[model samples]
Target: MSLYTTTLLILDPDPYNSIDRLYRRVIQQAMHVTLPTGCLDIFVARPPTRFRETHFVVAQLYKISAELKQLENKEDIDVRVLLEGVGGFDIGDARNRSWEVVAVGKSDSKLLPVFIAEQHSSWFSPALQIIILPMERSIETSSRLPSLPSDEDGSHPPTEEGPHLGEAGLVIDSTDEEGGDLDDEGEEAQYPIVALGGTFDHLHDGHKILLTMAGFLTGESLIIGVTGEALLQNKKYKEYLEPFPQRCAAVLNFLAYIYPALHATTDEINDVYGQSVTIEAIDALVISGETRQGAKLVNQERTRRGFHALKVWEIGVVNGDANDQWAGKLSSTDLRKREFEKGELAKGQGTQQKLE
Candidate 1:
């Protein structure tokens, strides 16, 4: 099969709720409609304000990609999760973020650009081939591209000279000849400081995946909020929870291993929001499914404090065993429970041997 690079823009509101179904659809589409193995850039356009929801979505996508690799026997499938800044979820923002994530230089020699969404939007470039899912129809045939805005004199602005159209219609130019520079042309625009918060206890596979994603999304630095001991006092399996300092150390170690070049800092958070709501430099916030509500609360606090809200990127819950009675994703609680059960079984076996 030919290698194809495609960027997918997901416009779903509750992507995590129907994760299994979404995964099936995505895999089916990838196998039948698009190339089975290539660079798949997935972007969730209107992610839930809650970090938990967003995290669930991301985790689901990660699981799906892994499953796809196993099923197709293609180990080289590159799947990247692209996140957008917090604000309006309009077509323009989605299109711009998509371009920003995939576009490297002025040329289109890398890969093919394809968009998949529930509905078609006019914000996409004319060169893009949009696929509307569930309906599974190409927007190129069903919808007409929107016309560019004209000046008061009814004349369209001159097209700025740039390099050849890239695979995903990425046009490279530092400055537009028509007037001012493009909004996303500066050095700072490429690398924005990002923040993420969690207890990060045990530092299992789930936490590792979340941290890995944060490292990827962050351009310059990653500010992590490890919940203080006081805040986690009421948590389940609190006795087994690692100390705040140890948790912080584990997080730092994991980040250093995955992203040796990234500048990562960890702080103790006593409250829910932490530095994400207070820090004005943070551009986005990475969250998992359990902390979704916390993200919304953080945004609310930011609004009250007259600070810009941080864009929240949610990751999905890692699925547990299929035969397990609990019908939810894998969690620290689950891990702890298994440990407790194993201890109890060991004790029972020792008692039986003594009696014998």
Candidate 2:
């Protein structure tokens, strides 16, 4: 099977809310639609800052990967997430970056880079482009490429020229025509105040996804419960754990970046329930699949305390690749273990050099 590395360019005005649907489309394109043969590398490029955080975007990619494993029954496609920096939104800049990412060494190859975008534009040189329309359109896959004008007799004529290769290689273009259309969709089902509790240690991509989802579900404010040090005493690699203040700062930094308008507050919690069980203002609770039972327990406590049971929203666990030395769901424990092993290896090398 031939492997094709394709970079998908998306103009996501608001990823925190649209990521779920965007990811679904990516999976559909790779599995049920085009490029089902070889290994497909889907690098999703989105504009940065106002509504999207790089970390959050990567987390969504991980979620997509996990879903693909279940839906496709294998890891044939590798999904990577890339962020278009502050000033890289221009069509030319995006084309340059996409080519740089996939064009590692095929300088003399005849393969023209495939460019997929929502609308057809002359800005892209037709002689140097292979444009694929968005998946939602009903056009045939072959019809997506720009076709030469037919003869007046309505018969298709063969042209001397083939598809022109773009200067930067393959380019895929896509637009977010649905942007802001679904913004209020989450509003109708909004929770005025949402609460989520976690150790948030090291704040990996998984944590960012959880935080981004929580922020998107919220309408007015969000309360993050950072686990206190006392609760992490029994955790593995406790010595390497980040301090509570640092963890809180990292969480807030991400929340602020993706949700600048959201009102956020962080507090220390020694217990699993935190203020969720007692806080009447909190309308919902966000948790990961692993901690879902904990959310139920918090609800139980709330019921006992005469408070309304908080709505529970669970995000799936971001699984790690089996190819990884430490294969399992992403967690702080796995990260710390990797770091510890690297340190030990360094020390062993130092000792061996000294003895020699």
Candidate 3:
């Protein structure tokens, strides 16, 4: 199937109750029309309350993505949630360990064939390949691009033109005047330098949320310690573990897109402490909920070395439905295993066909 490598989805919560239904319908429709395999950038606009309630946004998106796996012919879509634009809020003082709201915006060129709910259509222009949600059992748009068939029937035509920005819309660029100055009163002052460590193997949404939270906290620099080869020898599906360089590059690239305003540094760490124990300048450490105990060990080592204890912040794990084979947490190891299973299934199907 022909797919759009990257697509933008603009969302605005009209009554809050429809958010979940709206998201599911949009995904169901897009699968038929655009086949977004590379990435799905969800841009939420208006209703400043949604910005303040970020935990809801993150949880809802993750829920929808998890449900996508149950759908037939669902592709692996990298779901990214953005909360920056007209009537949107900035990444405020979201340092608490609780699932607080943290706004996000990206700097990317026009994403073609944008999918938006009919109620939130006022946020963008109609000249682009715009697909409205709650679709009339058909793919409807005002763009000059040819009309495509619905998810259930008809031909899937390719869209040639790119996305268009609304006259009053914001692109959330760091260099551009409109998107500039996102940080108010040195938002980084709370934490001059933020630090975090992870294996970052497959670079999934869980990793993105962790990194973004750290990036949002950083005022000066974001220090990421990518696990070295020595530490990853026993990882599950070790063969599928991405090379350290590739993993590091993916982390850096994602940071540039989501929070380009700050300078980020990545280091290869052979041990658990990494630079967090040695770097005296680091103001804070971002960790997942499961590693809260490790934060104490890090601080104890720092205090032993005559260094100040770093203020540690935590982010909750992105969870999938509990099942016998898969735990609740969205893990890279589980992702790798799923990929391996898919490969094995395809191999079995191919062999069966050959025998026939």
Best by lDDT: 3
Q: What digit string (tens of lDDT, one per residue) describes model 2 on residues 137-161?
A: 1212232122224367533343323
Model 2 global lDDT (CA atoms, 0 to 1): 0.54
Q: Which runs of model 2 end up more than 4 angstroms from their true locations?
A: 1-9, 12-60, 63-188, 320-327
lDDT of each: 0.54, 0.54, 0.57
Reference-based lDDT, residue 144, model 1 = 19
Q: Tell me how many residue pairs clash in candidate 2.
A: 9
Q: Give the Cα-based TM-score of candidate 3 against the true structure.
A: 0.64
The TM-score values for the models, in the order shown, are 0.48, 0.53, 0.64
Worst 10 residues of 3 by lDDT: 164-173
Q: lDDT by residue for model 3 over 198-242, one digit each (tens)?
A: 999888878877776676567778899999989888888998888
Q: Itemize residue pairs with steric clashes in candidate 2.
A: 113-170, 114-170, 114-171, 115-171, 115-172, 116-172, 116-173, 117-173, 117-174
Best by TM-score: 3
